[model samples]
Target: MFALITDIALTHIAGRGRQTLVSILGVALGVGFSIAMAALMQGSQEEFVTSLIDALPHVDITDEYRDPPRQPADLAFDVAAYSNLRPREDTRGILNATEAMTALRAFIKGNAVASLKVQAVARAGGAETGISLTGTDPVREALISSFDEDMRKGKLSDLRASPFGIVIGDKLAAKLTVDIGDTIVVSSTGDITRRFKVTGLFHTGVVAQDNAFGLVNLKAAQIIAGRPNAVNEIRVRLNDAQSARDVATQIERLIGYKSVSWQEANESLLEAFFIRNIIMFTVVGAILLVAGFGIFNIVSIITHEKSRDIAILKSLGFAERDVRLIFLSEGLAMGLAGSLLGWALGFGLTKVLASVKFEIAQATEVTHLPVTFDLLHYAIAASFAIIAAATAGYLPARKASKLNPVDIIRGAT
Candidate 1:
C-alpha cells in the first residue's frame, strides 16, 4: 500500500517537471547557503579563539588587586567622623613570591603554574621606546605557554644559556634596528640600567605582542626590575579551560592576589562572538523559510490540479489517509533529494573558500578565509530543510484529503 502511494506521488511530481525542479532547487539553495555561511563563521570563530588562547594565559595571577583595599583609617572610622584621615598608598609587588609559587603548585597539583617577572623598561636606541619584558624559566614556561613554538630565529633555551640573553619579538627587533648578537640597552625608572644581548626572536602573530614584548630569564628580569628574588606574576594552564574560573577563584582565596581567567579577561570579545552567531543563524534561517514558501506554493497547485484524480481514487475505495500520504511523500522526496545535493554543493563551495588566500599587513595569522567542514552543520541544514518541506506539504495534503469524492467528480463532469 505504501509503495503504491509513493508511486502515485512520484508520477504526479514527474508530470509537472518544471515546477518540481524549481521547488527542489529552491530548497537546495537554502540548505547550501546556510551550510556555507555556518562553515565560514564557525571556522573563523574557532581560529580566532585558538590564536587568542595561544597568545595569552588561560589564567593570570598578578600582584595587583581587582579592587584595592580601603585605607586603615577609613576601615577603622566612619567617613563623616574621620574624613581628614589620609589614605595610605597601596604597596606594589607580591610579597614572598617564591613561597606563594610553592603554595600554588601544591594547591593545583595537576595544573601548570609558572612564576614570571613582568616589567616595563625604556629601550634606548635612536629614540627611547617603552617595551614590556617578561622574565620566564624556559623549561617551565613552555608547559604553560606556546612561546617556544613561536620562536623564529633561535631557541627559548638560549636565554638560559647566557646570563644576559633575551628573546625579542620580530617587530620589536626591526623597530630597534637590532638582531641576534646585537646588544640593546634597557633602563628602568629605578635607576637600573642593563645592556642585554638579543639571542633570539619570535613572532606571536599578534601585532601588539610582536611589537612591544620581549622575553628574558627570571633572575635577569629580577635584577633589571631591582627586585632581586621576586616575581610579580604567575600564569596557569588547566587540563580543562572551562574550569579556569573556578580554579582562579580558589587561587585568589589562597594567595590573596588578583586571579583572572581568560574568559573574564576577554569578556567583550566573547560577547561579540556570541552576538555574531545569533545574527548569522537568524539571517540564514530566514532564507530557508523563504524556500519553504516556494514548496508550499508548488504543492498547493498540485493538489488543486489533481482534484479530479483524487475524487476518482476515492470513489474506487482508496482511503482519504492514502491520498494525504501520497502528497506528503512528494514533499519528502523533494526535501531528501534537495538535502543531498545541497550538502555536495556546500562542501564544494567551502573547499573553494578555503583555498582563497590574501595577505594583510599586521595580520600574520590570517592568510585565507577559514572554512571548517563540521558535520554538525550539514546535519542541521538537512534537518531544517526536511522539516520545512514536510510542514509545507502538510497543509496541501490536508486539503486534498478533505475533498468529497461525489462533489469533486460531479463538478468535473
Candidate 2:
C-alpha cells in the first residue's frame, strides 16, 4: 500500500517536474542558509570573547565590590599548592606586587615556580592624563602577558632590574612627546610628582587602553606612592584560561579578597555572544519561514489542479487518510531531497567563504572564518522544514479528497 502511494505521488511529481524542481531549489537555499548561519554563530562568539579579554587584565582580585565574596576560613594555602601546574602562553593579571610575592614565597616553599604583579595609577604630566599604571615583575610577568610584541618601540621595564624605568604605549608616548631614556614628569593619582626615564614604547592595538594605560616596576610604583607594601589589585594565573573562573573563586576563598574572572569582569561582552546567536537564528528562521509559504502555495495549486482526479479516487474507494498520506509523501520527499542537497551546499559554501578573507585594518587582520557542521542542528532544521511542508499540504489535500465525484467530473454544468 505504501509503495502504491509513493508511486502515485512520484507519477504526479514527474508530470510537473519543472514546478517540483523550483520548489526543491527554494527549500534547499533556505535550509542551506540556516545551517551555515548556526555553524558560524558559535565560532564568531569565541572570537569576540577572545578579543574582549585582550582588552583588560586576564583576571582581577580586589576588595570585593559587591557583598563580601565568601571564602572558607579553613581554605589557606599559598601559590605553592599548584607548583607543578604551569601557566599557559596567554596569561596576565595584576597582583598586589609586594604582598603577592610574600604570599607566593610562603605558599611555594621552594617547591616550583611562582609570579607577581601590581596595579597603580598615575596622574600623568598634569590632571589631564589619568594614567593607569600596571607594575609588573619582569621574571614572572612573561608567564601571563607579553608587552614586547605589542610594543611599537623599546621594551617593558624589569621592576627588579630597572630602578625608575617605565614603558608607555606608542599613542601615550606621542601624547607626552618624550622618547626612550627621556625623563617624563609623572604624578601618582594621590598628588605626588616624580621623574621616570621612558625606557620603552608599546601598543596593544586598542586605542583607549594604550592611550591611557602605562607599565612600570612594582618597586618604583610602591616607592612613588610612599608605601612599602600595598597594592590595590592582584592578577592570578592558572593552568587554563577556561579554568579562570574556578581559579578566581579559589583565589577569593584562599586570600579573603574580592576577585572577578575575565567573564564576570566583562559580563556585557560575554552576554553579547548569546545575543548574537539568538539574532542569527531568528533571522535565518525567518528566511526558512518564507520558503515554507512557497511549499504551501505550490501544494495548494497542485490540489486545485487534481480535484477531478481526487474525486475519481474517492469514487474508487480511496479514504481521506490515504489521500492525505499521498500528498504528505510528496511534501516529505521534497523536504528530504532539499535537505540533503542543502547540507552539501552549506558545507561547500562555508569552506569557500572561509578561504575568501579581508582585513578591517592594518592592526586587525581578517583570518579564516570559522564554521562547523553539526548533525543535530542539521537534523532539527530538516525536521522542521519537513513538518511545515507536510502540514501545509494537508488542508488542501483533504479538501480535494472530499469532493463529490459527480460535481467534480461534470465540470459544474
Q: Candidate 2 regions off by >4 Å?
A: 1-4, 39-41, 68-128, 146-149, 152-160, 179-182, 237-250, 308-321, 359-383, 395-413
Candidate 2 residue 303 Cα shift, in angstroms, is: 2.9
TM-score, model 1 to reference: 0.91
Q: Mind giving the per-residue lDDT tens digits that candidate 1 earns over 1-413? A: 99999999999988888988998898888888889899999999998987777777778999888788866667877763445666555336678777777887886734454455555664647855678888888777777888899999988888888888888889889888888988988876567889999999998877787888888888888887777767678888776776778888998999889999888998999999999999998887787788788888888999999999999999998898999998898888888878888898888888888999998876655598988999999999989999988988888999999999999878988
Candidate 2 lDDT (Cα, whole model)?
0.66
List TM-score per model, in order: 0.91, 0.74
C-alpha lDDT of all candidate models, in order: 0.84, 0.66
- Worst ten-residue run, lDDT, model 1? 109-118
| Candidate 2 lDDT tens digits, 270-361 | 77877887787787677767666777777777777777777777778888877877777777777777778778877777677667676656
Off by over 4 Å in 1: 73-90, 107-119, 361-366
Which pairs clash in the backbone of model 1? none
